[model samples]
Target: MESSSAAQSVVETWSAEATSLAGAFRVVARHHPDDIAVKDEENVLGYRELDDLSDRIAARLRARGAVDGQLVGVVIDRSVSTPAALLGVLKAGCAYVPLDPAYPESRLRHAVGDCALEIVVGDPKTVDQCGLGALRVVDPGAGHDGGAPPAGEIEADASAYVIYTSGSTGLPKGCVVSHGNVLALLRHTLPLFDVGPADRWTLFHSACFDFSVWELWGALLTGATAVCVPAETARAPEEFLDLLERERVTVLSQVPSAFRALCRMAGAAAPDLSLRYVVFGGESLDLDLVGEFVRHTAPRPPVMVNMYGITETTVHSTIRFLTGQDLDGKGTAPVGRPLPHVVISLRDRDMRPVPAGEAGEMYIAGEGVAKGYLNRPELTAERFLTLDTDDGPRRFYRTGDLGRETESGELEYLGRNDQQVKVRGFRIEPGEIETALRDHPTVRDAAVIAHDSAQGATLLACVVLRDGEPGRPAEAALRRHLATRLPAHMVPRRFAFLDDLPLTLSGKLDRNALLGLAGAGRNGRP
Candidate 1:
């Protein structure tokens, strides 16, 4: 009866805070103002301080003409200030666009221009480097004169944030997610994790990545402490373990590759840590790594949860908790069941539901689905669909990912239907890498494909040079050229020079043929 009463209280809190992300955080702040809300290596912010700082930042943004429905770009690095900017944007009822300061200027410009972003909040140096003349730049951490701003009267459907993702057209598209979408996601995940103010979640993912949404907001909204993991620490397993231990992190979200690195560093014994939940997402979870992790950890190791999701469907759509038996030298673990309110449908080419156990494109329908790609109605219509269901016309987002339902009704992810690939937990489009390669003067044509080996998948680029285009460029030089235009993950690890790209009889680039060649090149097959 006591447990039932506690469950009822949790339900009531979720229901009351379901209106908006900001509102939910506000509720927590009001209830627990003195509690530590967020902590980074540089600083720690209490709930009251976070609320007060964000309110001041919002007041400053409003003074500078920021209004509801406007999109604000945040080009700051990972820190406590980042969340302040995000919450401030919400306080002004504007959607905040997260931009990594490390991203190429060209890519940044495209995202800023695509959204017609007027105001960007960041450090003064980073803001200046953005090079948007018309952009109104503000340092959210700068001192404010007037009192705290009034809380925004934001509606549930208002745009909360826009996260740009790789597009097949060699550009990034912004997915405008609503406050209600985020609320729904938190609603489903909180109960699953049994999260509360006592938990400490790590913000291990980049601010631009969708996973950070779950990390940052998930903590603040639930009155939990969010500990920021430094970029260098996140990449280095020893440092990450130290930070996790020092912070006493209870919830840790990581990609399979990174977790494997951590396990390799930790060896046979699990370090004494307070981790209760270790969630995996962003890429396919390796069963071998999962098995190794289970063996290395203590008898009551952290519960491993695999979440399958996309940017279009907010951060997560489905989740599966893994047990030691689930990783008993079997195939891949299923992505588990859909969130309570979410509807998952496996549809064929004709948009008809496929039979049980058959592969089909996964379609997500529910509150977590985004409003659509910003300013790209045609593409939005192509991906986000409205299908007739038994109840009525329901909206769905085509994930472009292939999956099959298991006997237990869990979704097992198949590969994508397109050139999109996940390398080191980052979703990358081969077209983007190909486009960058084509930009080089020595390269006439280029095709990029992911090559999988014992060390996992690495990108390989096939290049065709222009006639008499100077001396053949060194692979190192070509990589340097791509580095200026693309992120490290998107850059090809190996390059193969080809006289011409293989083409299908349909006159399209034959990706399968290219993959075969890439595999042979990787294996030193002549």
Candidate 2:
């Protein structure tokens, strides 16, 4: 926790003025009552209208027994009503837990039951399907009388929301983030993008993902317009592009895989876009794709930023503004420097800071770190660490992501520690192989995975070829091409051609599904 001048400056200069989500949003709503706040394809809600709807919903929630520090389940799709429900939950002095209507009944039941939720604000039919008959379901669009109480005030440390992430053990764990955590993230990020009332942001990710927390709050709190992308359109890159153009979206954020698909859909010519900044997150960004995108675009398309973040650390931790030079020379694009008021440490297995350019586990500390997992104290204790530094006692979240610091103090991401593979006694990172596969002229997208079965550990390469390309590459041809740059053992032993790789709800590569596709048994044995 030794203080760098940059880190110290961040701590000294920045402090959140907003105490609650509803409180901060009210300031914007009052300032720009006539500006459009939330919109979808069919409907638009001005700032005043959205605020009034949320206030009404808050009154309903209070009547049903919601109180300060309680959990309120929000089970709505990506519509204008969704933001109203979220803000309504906060106004009721409760933390909103997003329950996607598209999720399975079993997962939704587990989320509600595990949290002991008593009230849900969403579509009534979806609530019934989830078997939440005992709990009260308040529709976001319901009418209410004019006797709504004043929006309650909340402490900075009170939980704002709970987002569940899939755990290694099969069950999902909820991350509890405070209002101050999100306010700090918004304060640091909005300035970087120069967000304002004139900007329009697209909520492209699912409500359950932490990325949506940034997408939604960053726009609403800034008095900017937040456009909701439909579920069907979000799945198709071509359709997504059309939505962006039609909405005149200025600030956009997408997973690297999804952006790569957009580039493929456009081919060599970049469409005229109104975007000013396009942020890539939720997965490793392939520099090859970055180069491809730059090639198709005009002299200057949008400012491309690669950000690395974890749900435990709010949404984003680092931000790097990528340039043409980054596209020209790189293995993987750097994740950029730490955000203001954030500290990054690369520590080895012994908990000692690693020397420069050596890979180690990343530990993030400062304003962005979350409170901890909801009901898993043991897991929280293991991941969240407290260390004494010259500045003071600092709490750090172990990211489990291995990375090294560059000479310029930026972080270069290596693959995940668990993803490091040992094949034929040689340690290999699948990202490097994936990078190699992407360099091939015929390949458009690629994923490399390691599978261990009765036949022993083998590397598998799954790829999608470019349109108008001939049949899939032969296994021998791919292996031969890989051998030119990689060691024999690092080359994949088997290859599978797929039209596209499976992605998780967050749009990251679904390695578990890839393992299953590779013919590995449930226990990882053939």
Candidate 3:
């Protein structure tokens, strides 16, 4: 009887929470109908307009045979219509899959086929390109959602959205996110960042990137304005900074590489601006770059948050807020404690809990845990395993990242275990070497991968230089740079200059491609 009561309570609480988020959307629209809800370079939509447009889009998609629980794909860049399509899909009781407009046709099809997408909602070009049954997401006028369809009561486990993961081996796989996961995340993030109806955010990251999950829902669901930075602008940091200043963007997110470029632009040409929140993800945080940002833009330091997680966990699993005092001893801040509804833990290979300060595989569980990889049940079973903890049948996602729980409850990332190298019986994580190489002033981006050589085993560093920098920083200079920051064995044996580092479709460094290039250029033992 007690167990039954507990289960009933859990169900009731989550059901109420899900409805609360959807209910907020209507309230925000009614209260601040004229407020800017979303702005891309091409268009700016008011809250009232978006609410009505989404309804029409939902109605149109419904007309096109889109049904509840159906998988819908939207192919577009960062734009106002983007959010409208998202709202429409959800209102129609279906999960939406975001596709990058810039991805190659092959990759686009791979995502569509994998998700079994039925209708497409986008411009004519992408609609035909997506090759789904429907051509586009129908745009509805303001103050409408396809006949004010009743917002269905959603269970904690119902699919909320599906984001494609750029698979290392084959085609990309979609990670299923539940409504509960998103709502839990929004509850923590909205208050944590202090975003409200009046705030305006610069949507810098690509829609397909998981970070956009935060940039989009973090605002629309809360009634805050989301300003979409154009692809052309985001591709060029100097241009993006200028547009951001004029747009009055209050929140922005970028990768470390992009942030470095923005700092460079600030040094060359300063933009008049007022930004309150600056967030970063998709890679490790570089304290040096953060320092540069502070030096150039002083007085009120925009809140710098380093978030960590992958597509599977929705948007973020951990975040570290960098303050002036925290920068004293460390070159970089730790990935902070898990948000509410999330539990981050360190575990040994056998899934047993490890003591704090001991490096082990990182596991995350709670409301943020995803529904596993779509259509890949076996893979899901392997990665998202059940934990027999005191919490009872808790689903923990094996992040594959090796992390040590700090004495302060933060997580210190130690790199991937499987990628750890065994050279003459010594385990080495290339991440340590890569991080060291990035310390070099001239290096803008760096990647270190283990390679086999005639001389037994070795590692190589491929680095991209900052523009206007002197001839490639010598390998000796790079080696000396690493020696100072890392142990001798963790230093790379060879360093090469890359005009541009190859990135995966998802924008993360393509390690496999790096290895392939290294293998072709030099003889490395695998």
Candidate 4:
């Protein structure tokens, strides 16, 4: 076996030569032509086969008059075609804008109009259902005349994709990521692991979420297999666990809330798994539940890593490996050091660096920083600023997340600055209260949201109880449990019991949905 350092050196050497994502994938395909590149329920494709299919896709796009740097919309389901369509778009020198078919018609319409998309590649049925009939649609499954792809060299700075994230103004904003940005992320991060062509990775996230960017490219660029998980299988814990075990997946990435359900099922079933890495992202992880999971895994557990990142700064920024010792301490969740090409600094509202152990907004500056939000120049200018550094000057994206550095030099996520709510003159972070609630033996998961009534704003907690528990804990008892760990004012005023918390399509906590549920007061009491 090669030494870890030697493996890392090899990865670094080859990755440095890569310019565009499609170009890098072509290099891998040339070397491992017969290797499995992707697989779905209906089809299995080898590297060379997928390459040829994508070339045809590029040929079709060129025939449709797509020019370099133009935006092409992709409205497809999660399957073998998804990767081919995305790769085809990039290979044709056009950036892809993923439009999930599941999104509402209005949201889809907004994305289409905002991007000024002229052509879309999608399943005919899905395109019709999404009401995108105005734009020309190219079916990925349709047959095309065999022809060589357009000959051209794509620049590293060229846009690869535009991912739309929810905006505070009740609309969606797109972030433009370039080929170099993604290459930098892979070059710095992939060398840390011992992955090879034999490994199988799961594409569990939707194409719309930035997490899928990591999942898809991480496998393809490294000559590994990407097993496309069906939408229904991804939502069902039991089915997802079976798929992992049956497929012998090696690398699994999930949002913390989604993993909690899988962990619970795994604790009971104890199915044999082949996972080497279980990466957590998309939300704050509950360390108490992590401890429980570690204990259940016993003698040997997969390397569980909690990654803190934002869509604008690629998929990952800081990474912390979770060990038993980390759970033994009372310290907050640590999101570890930055990736090799990334720089992280915590600063106050005035852009001054805060003292160590003091909470401040996180500002990221590095090769992985994206080009900026699409078409919204004012918003982009406000969020992405250039700061003077010892190295002269560098651009940084101001992340609204709050964090503090520990004495050990690792970052501990303190929750989002916007999530802080004030109740009766006391500013409270609901994450702290939710953490306290999860620490209780009977509580499995918890979400706290501020609800405003005619009288005033108050904190309401929606909780999921652990399985096999005798009965629901009284509201007063739950409150007393929280009182011991939190300040009196931080305790929630209303308590609600839920079978499971509402989650967005990206597997994140739906705060808006939670607030609505709290208002309904289903199985809740003051």
lDDT value, candidate 2, whole model: 0.83
Structural similarity to truth (TM-score) of each candidate: 0.80, 0.93, 0.88, 0.96
Residue 135 alpha-carbon offset, candidate 2, angstroms: 1.8
Give every collision pair in model 2: none
Pick the winner on lDDT between candidates 2 and 4: 4
The candidate that wins on lDDT is 4
lDDT of 4 by residue, 1-526 (tens): 1224533653554566568888888878887899999999889999999998899888888888888999999996879999999999999899999998888999999999999999999887889889998888888888785456666658889999999999989899999999999988887888777777788999999999999999999898878899999999999999999999899999899998888898898888887888888888888877766776666666666778889898999999988888778877643458888988899989999999898899999999999999999999999999999998778788999999999888999888999999899998999989989888887878888999999865588888898888876435556778889988988889987887888888899999999998888788766664
**Clash count for each candidate, listed in order shown:** 0, 0, 7, 0
What lDDT would each prediction earn against the true structure? 0.80, 0.83, 0.73, 0.86
Runs off by more than 4 Å, candidate 4: 1-17, 330-332, 470-472
- Model 2: residues with Cα > 4 Å off, grouped in runs: 1-17, 145-147, 268-270, 520-526
lDDT of 1 by residue, 1-526 (tens): 0123322344357567557777777777887899999989989999999998998888888888887789998885768999999898888778899888667889889998898888898887777876764588878889895545555457889999888887888888999999889888877666767667888999888878888899898888767899988877876688989888889999998865457567766563367788888888876665656776766666757888999888889899998888667888444567888988699999999999999999999999999999999999999999999998877899999988889998988898876778578889998877567656766767656778888866588888888775665434557678899999888888877778776667432123567798888767742223
In model 1, the runs with Cα more than 4 Å from the true position are 1-11, 132-134, 146-148, 268-270, 419-523
Provide the lDDT at 303 for model 2. Answer: 78
| Whole-model alpha-carbon lDDT for candidate 3 | 0.73
Q: Over the stretch 1-526, how does candidate 3's per-residue lDDT look in tens digits? A: 0123322332334344455334446656776789888887778889888887877777777767887778888776667888888877777677888877677778778887888776777776556654543434443332344455445654556676888775656767789887778777776555566556656777767767878878887776666789887777776777888987788787888777567667778767756667777888877777777776776667755778888887777788887888777655435557787876688878998889987689989888877888899999888999998888876878899988888877777887777777888766678877777666666777777878777777667777877777877544366677777778777777777666776677654456778888877777642213
Candidates sorted on TM-score, descending: 4, 2, 3, 1
The better-scoring model by lDDT among 2 and 3 is: 2
